[model samples]
Target: MTKALLKYTGEVEWTPPAIYKSSCKIDVLYFPFDQQSCNMRFGSWTYNGFQVDLKHMNQKPGSNIVPVGINLSEFYLSVEWDIIRVPAIRNEEYYPCCKEPFSDIVFNLTMRRKTLFYTVNLIIPCVGITFLTVLVYYLPADSGEKVSLCSSILVSLTVFFLLLAEIIPPTSLAVPLLGKYILFTMIIVSLSICVTVGVLNIHFRGPSTHTMGPCMRKIFLHIMPKILFMRRPPYNPGDILYREDTDGDGYIDGDYSIDSCGDIKDGSKDCLNYDCSNFKSGLHDDEHRGRASVADADNVIPRQLTPEILSAFEGVRFIAQHIKDADKDNEIVEDWKYVSMVLDRFFLCVFTAACVLGTCGIIFQAPSLYDNTAPIDIQMTRITQYGISSPPTVAPRL
Candidate 1:
């Protein structure tokens, strides 16, 4: 028997097999079969390949090779995989299409692309919902139709989360890009709902001129509740809402005044009757609800906003300043209240940006998607004393 030894190029940084000084080898054996398994026969066909130890796979650095009994002339491909699907680990072999080993084994590999399904879906929707948040700042608050645009976006975000959960297998795996965005969409949606509550809260407090501007009142009453910031106190008893026959007409007084909050200091000036005898029923109050009713509500107008509402809504003072022109004070108060509605939009933007940026920061830290991401190497060889040279085929990078 003639022995052919193939040497390692050392171009591959690997420890040598102890049996060989400078070479590792494969022995080729040719067998003749008159008949194969009863059902099958290679009547006119020639076959090639090798059997390698499953434990000691031979491969170059940065390569995944699955060894099979074959030669370079036959075929070239090596695939790596884990039998158990264990994460971050792989098992593989190369059917170099040959019976030779070491340098004589020639192989070629083509890379396959891996797509991140979660990232695409999650990211797009995250951006879409973020845009709607900005839209909140632009739409008119008093449409009376209720700022419904926010509700629509909020619902969309919920569907996105459900969709993501369906597509991805739950694992202790690092959070996926898409999963993060879905989470963000949900967060933004929740925030938008809160903002809507704020708008409603402000509107519920009667008109803009009476107490805090509607917008300001909304933030103080509703949205802030989520942050545990403060609760909007139910409005107070109009300081002057007492049952008295002021003009002896026998009808009790039903007036609401900011001065209701005063503790005898402002003196009964606002508490006094407005001389309603000459005054007709308030056409403005009749147009709106939540005001001095036929009598003050049993939950009577609050003497003042809940102390908590008073503290969290510093923005109310800002609205009060806008009522500059005395003649138009009422109208300006309403407008300032309108401006306050945006506080909901403002807070959501702040939170959404934080969530998106945080998700992006997570992606930047992932493994680089490039040539070295996934590696494949193939090998094929034929054993013979006579030397045979094969050309290296250009392989695609992963």
Candidate 2:
């Protein structure tokens, strides 16, 4: 009111500095990329609309001019939030207790959270941990580190979840996108631990401990190897042939000396009592005549072979049978190990794909992640003395 009467129009202006604390409802569905709108209403407490009127200070004296919501020429910038828009409107309302209308100015403060801090501190580290979870399948089972690695990663994700719990408000309405991603990653890690245990069990299995079944052998050894593009050397029983000269005979005891009839020679009674006539039943016409002649030669030969030679022959057969059984067992054990390897390769592919897709799907669910458009300009329709009227729309500022 200082010197206001001196002016021809008698208008006075006053500027005051004030601080306000506002409580805004936070929607953390998109978290760091989220936008929030908080309204600040200003009005005189005692005077009614008829006695005291409220108007946007930036409104001009033209019908087509748009009202600037707030003066930002001297506004200080914030590090964590960007002011998207500040739209103000003048409202009039009639209360039940009063005959006159109440007037107020409402300023809608729209802000977007800046994502660089969350990206650097939270997001990138989470992505790294997700990739590390995939690496658990790559480590060899014999290295004895897979379970330990999974445990460490699970603990790390738990720590991250705890940190996020502290940052986010304790509301049960909805879970934040970042929290969902962390939980998903933790679950994948936990499953990896179970998979590692299974793989280790398969890798160390022995024929004596667990016999390989037909279905398992077909899936892991026959089918999965081809699907995963794995290659292995074909098993050769002869390659693992073991020879022992138990009596300095310089011959592999595993090799049995056989006659033309496929029976052991050197006076084994089982061979001496051989039923040569049985060969005729399955032989062709010419093969039967050849076997008939061989049977006559077999009948003339060898009841004179000594008891000591027979005992040596039996001992050699026993050693040979033992060696053959050992080789078969060894092959089975190796097959189990190979099957374990195939499983590791299979899971490596699966976890890598799941981790990549799940991470991208969850992270990109926020609309603002890919949106590059400029901030929207909110136009306020003027509420005039007669009625509400549509105002001229302005293009958004870039």
Candidate 3:
């Protein structure tokens, strides 16, 4: 009893201090943004409503019609939870063993979770790591680090999931919003690894190993490069064309041209076609002209050395042809590499869009994330009227 009335007033007041320990079922579909309502029932179990009726002490002045909920004047605030409201209602139930009804007061304590801790520690880091998947395509394929980065990001996400598992309940009823987002990100990272492998394969292709068809060349080289805004350096023919005077003679060592009949043309007026079938005939003609000039001048025949000189010229032409073929092969290999670069740029754009849309779409699905209302205030009274008091004496303390 908080206060005692006069001896003859026939009135009394009671106040009891007690502690309660209870558990409430939790719904974690929204996780960090979830709100929970826990109901606490208070009533006397031994007495029925007819003998010991329960009444709400905090009511409006001069009226027993409106019932005000519990007081919060001494309620301590929590850092992680915000008290949304505390509404109390009176209920009466009849049991088979009792004729009268049993009345009880149910206080519903509704609270909203504060998201600052989760946003900084879990959500932001997950989002940042998920976005890194798109940048894997931006990295150069030749660097050889794309797969390593993807693996590391996958591991990090798994760690975050474990941490989250420890924090939330392990019920398999429904996956949380954050869990869905993490799983989606892991799938994206795994897909990125597959894409990186393909890009590397395309980058390392050679002309001898793989032949690029016209359709592929048109799409990867002509069309896709334009869409991706990729441009190759200007072509220079002089860079690939080899020119060297190996013998240090007045003329270039391998300065020969191939005609339509596959004949090597050495710069001379008479020897227009240097085919092996007509080599002896052309050499004999040159020797005959030389002998005639020598006979006409000093009766001396020129030495027959034309066959050896022609064989030496053929060797030089063969080396020059090999060099030219190598240059063409290098150009083809460069085209394949450029095609790989275009694909990388294309995937970069695609993964970036997917990451952004997936993050926004999954996170905003929570209903309470958009709530901006303030916590409701419950009025408190210094004194409470539980039952009738004789002589109309008021309680000094409650």
Which has the greatest TM-score? Answer: 2
Clashing pairs in 3: none
Per-residue lDDT of 320-360 in model 2, one digit per residue for the tens? 56666787899998998899899999999999999999988
Q: Give lDDT tens digits, candidate 1, residues 130-241.
A: 5666566446566654357767777777777677667554555346555555565667666666766776666444343355657755664466555644334333232343
Question: Candidate 2 vs candidate 3: which has greater lDDT?
Answer: 2
Give lDDT per model, in order: 0.41, 0.71, 0.71
Off by over 4 Å in 3: 1-16, 44-52, 59-68, 93-102, 234-313, 376-398
Model 2 lDDT vs. the true structure? 0.71
Tell me the tens digit of each residue's lDDT in model 3 across 1-398: 24433336433333445557779988889888888889888788898988776655554454433222655544445678877767667778898998899988777778898899999999999999999898899888889999899999999999998999998888898898888889999999999999889999999999889999999999998998888888889643333323323454343333333221123333221122245325445444655676433122212212432556546545656754665567578888888889889999999999999999999999998888888767643123222244322321222122
Worst 10 residues of 1 by lDDT: 28-37
Question: How many collisions per candidate?
Answer: 28, 0, 0
Model 1 has an lDDT value of: 0.41
List the candidates ranked by TM-score, beginning with the highest.
2, 3, 1
Q: Which candidate is the best by lDDT?
A: 2
